[model samples]
Target: MTPQMRHRLVHAGWLAAALAALGGVFVLYVHPDFLVTLVDQVWSCF
Candidate 1:
């Protein structure tokens, strides 16, 4: 493959990862209870 194509593929992969992360954040914002539960579970380990 050409260098340009490889570069584009890498960029697209990064974009997809960023979008997925943003979506996860949006879900947490939409349902704060989920985040609270997650934090609670983590704190319980202490």
Candidate 2:
């Protein structure tokens, strides 16, 4: 692939990752119980 195409693909990948991160944050904010459960599970693993 061309350099320009590769650059565009890299940029798109970063954007997609950022949006997914933001979505996950929103979900956690809306349902804090999920976060609590996750923490509990992790603590149990120790």
Candidate 3:
């Protein structure tokens, strides 16, 4: 592959990863149990 094509592929990979992370966060936010479990875990660290 060309250097320019490789650069574009890398950029697309990062964008995809970011989108997936955001989607996962959104799904977790929509689930109350996940929030409660997350809070409990954090609180335990204190």
Candidate 4:
């Protein structure tokens, strides 16, 4: 592939990865149990 095409592909891949991560976080946040557990775990660290 051309250099420009490779650069675009890399940028697109990063965007896709970020979107997937956000989606995963959104799914987790949609569950009340997950948020409670997460808060408990964080609170335990202090």
Candidate 5:
């Protein structure tokens, strides 16, 4: 890949990871029950 393409991809990956981390923080601090619901949904698929 070109240098510019590689740079863009790396930046995008970092942004996605940062957004995911922020979401986790919000869920932990603002809505702790989100985790419980998430687990329940996941288990329900079984």
Candidate 6:
């Protein structure tokens, strides 16, 4: 892969991880129902 592609892939992976972490926090502190909703939202993008 090209350098630009590699960088973009890494960035995307980090973004996905960050979103998942946020979802975990919401599920822990706000509402458990958000966990499934957020995960499904994330997966639906791809």
Which is the winner by lDDT between candidate 1 and candidate 5? 1
lDDT of each: 0.99, 0.99, 0.96, 0.95, 0.93, 0.89
Tens-place lDDT digits, model 3, residues 1-46: 9999999999999999999999999998899798899899999999
Candidate 5: regions farther than 4 A off: 33-46
Q: lDDT for model 2, please.
A: 0.99
Over 4 Å off, model 3: 38-46
- If both were scored by lDDT, which would come out higher, candidate 2 or candidate 6? 2
Alpha-carbon shift of residue 40 in model 5 (angstroms): 20
lDDT of predicted model 1: 0.99
Compose the digit string of candidate 5's lDDT tens values, residues 1-46.
9999999999999999999999889878798688789899999999
lDDT of 4 at 40: 100
Please give me the total number of clashing residue pairs in predicted model 3. 0
List per-candidate RMSD values in Å.
0.5, 1.0, 1.5, 1.8, 3.5, 9.0
Per-residue lDDT for 1-46 in model 6, tens only? 9999999999999999999999878767777567778789999999
Residue 37 CA error for candidate 3 (Å)?
3.6
TM-score of each: 0.94, 0.87, 0.73, 0.68, 0.63, 0.63
Candidate with the greatest TM-score versus the true structure: 1
Model 2's TM-score against the true structure: 0.87
Considering TM-score, which of the candidate structures 1 and 6 is the better prediction for this target?
A: 1
Model 4, 1-46: lDDT tens per residue? 9999999999999999999999999998789798899899999999
